[model samples]
Target: MHIGKAIRLERIFDRNTKRAIIVPMDHGVSVGPIDGIVNMKEAVGKVVEGGANAVVEHKGLVRCGHRAEGKDIGLIVHLSASTSLSPFPNAKCLVASVEDAIRLGADAVSIHVNLGDETERRMLHDMGKVASDAANWGMPLLAMVYARGPKVKSEFDPETVAHCARVGTELGADVVKVPYTGDKASFEHVCDSCCIPVVIAGGPKLDSTEAFLRMVHDSLEAGGAGLSVGRNVFQHENPTRLVQSLNMIVHEDASVAEALAHLNG
Candidate 1:
């Protein structure tokens, strides 16, 4: 691996703790102007202040200077795009190149792949090509895999999510971001089968902070590296407060109750 790629991976991989707190700001490309990220600077600041290890964002977000805005955190740029407004929302397009990501001073780059759809073959081809280019540059690759084909079970299915993880690693994703199955016993099969570090995605925000914390706790118990959460922290009335509580659970090993206590602390 190139020195640039190695250093980038180390920054987010958290070898010391074997975990990370990543805030994914790439949602704008997929869902368009969602909560919290409307004011990108404030959102980025909230996570950085709360001790997030990295922020995953699209080229537009990166160009907004969130990384420089939060000097301490690593920036992983997403090279894919598939907007809700598109005719085919599942057909991810390669919008940014690895070269552009490197030029923009990104620490790493990410790709999105959704399996079991008519668009599956195109996405896999794009991912494999992007990964090959990224590897040539020695850039670390983060794969956001979702099982969304005609045959996909519910998004929460453990078996489907496990396949997502396995396929991503087999195709060369350095880190795989996936949904957390409610039970550790089921998700363990996911973590155990994939060789690369696995991170859990915070899906649509839950109604209660406690619910969010419970998911985070369960993911860690299942051997997840950390989280790539969006609305749960950013959409909250107090992003700083929410991130503070989440940071306790992610990096400090605080239980859900203890972390919730820090919400107001």
Candidate 2:
């Protein structure tokens, strides 16, 4: 591994735990400014105060979330985008470059690839190109891979999730994020098959906080590196407390009960 890549990854993944609690705030490009993230600096501060390892955002919004005084948090510049209003929303296109992330002082860069989409080939090509550029620049790359298309019955299907993870690894991502496959056993298989660190995506907001915490705990127990969740963490009633509870599970190895207790306390 390049020393630069390793050093940058430390910003995103805890050095002691080799895991991460990443909050993706890049949704502004995909779905417009939603709750919790409209004030980028405040949202970033809350999660950072809760000990989140990193926050992902698009290049332009970097200025909005930049902190002048506070505990530092890693910045991951998202390189691909497709708005929800687009006719082919699943088709993610490269909107930024590895060089752009470097210029923005990002610790890492990320791209999204939706397998089984009509523009899967183009996304894959973009990913491949970005991976090469990132490697050349020694910038850590996080691939957000998912199976979302007509043929896919359930995106949560373990097999499909594993395939998405594997694709990320084969394409040279240092870390890969995918939807959790519902249970520890199934998700364990997904993690086992990928050589690179695998993290779980938060997906849609769950009905309850305990349910969300339980999912995080289960994925960690399954050998997942940790989570790159968005809405669940940022949109929670208490974003700071929520991420602190998550930190306990991801870094302190707390059980669901213990983490939930921390959340409530």
Candidate 3:
């Protein structure tokens, strides 16, 4: 890795722990203004106050969320976008470039790719171009890879998720994010298949906080770098508390019970 890339990566991943608690606030592009992130500034503030390492958002919203004061957090500019209203919503398009993210003072850039989607080929082509540009500019790239196509029988299948992880690494992402394989053993295989840091994506919001915490715990046990969770963190009744709980789990290696206690207490 280039020194510049490493330095920028340190902003998002803890230097000592080498892990991250990233809250994605970029969902507004895909799903419209969701509940937690309707007020971008407030949502960003809540996560930063609770010790999130970074927040992922699209280029347009950077100014809305950027803070000159208060606890500092890394900014990751998401380059790809797709609207939920689209007939093929899984087909993501690159709306920003590495140069654009740098101009926005981003610590990193991210792209989303649906591996089995009908538009997967185009997405992969764009990803390759982004990876090349990121490398040239010495910017770290995080790939949010998913298997959400017609042929995908199970998005969380260990083998399928492992392929997703590898696709990111093979395409030159610094960190890869994929859905967890539902257990430590299966998830471990997903982690082991990728050379770069593997982070688990928090899918939909779960019914219980304990289940969420437990999933984080299990993913970490299976050698995940951390989490790129959004809805579960930002939509919670206490967003800060939830992020703090995740921080404990990802950075301090706290037990699920202990992390839950921190959230509740």
TM-score of each model, in listed order: 0.95, 0.99, 0.99
Sliding window of 10 residues with minimal summed lDDT for model 1: 62-71
| Model 1 per-residue lDDT tens digits across residues 43-133 | 7887778777888888777756454544578889899888888878988879999998888888889999989878999999999998899
Candidate 2, poorest ten consecutive residues by summed lDDT = 212-221
Task: State which candidate, 1 or 3, has the greater lDDT.
Answer: 3
Superior candidate under lDDT, 1 versus 2: 2
lDDT of each: 0.85, 0.95, 0.94
Over the stretch 56-160, how does candidate 3's per-residue lDDT look in tens digits?
999999999877789899999999999999998999999999999999999999999999898999999999999999999999999999999989999999999
* Residue 22, model 3: Cα distance from true site in angstroms: 0.4
Query: Pairing residues by index, what is the TM-score of model 3?
Result: 0.99
For model 2, how many clashes?
0
Which portions of model 1 miss their true places by more than 4 Å?
1-3, 67-71
> What is the Cα-based lDDT of residue 49 in candidate 3?
93
- Reference-based TM-score, model 1: 0.95
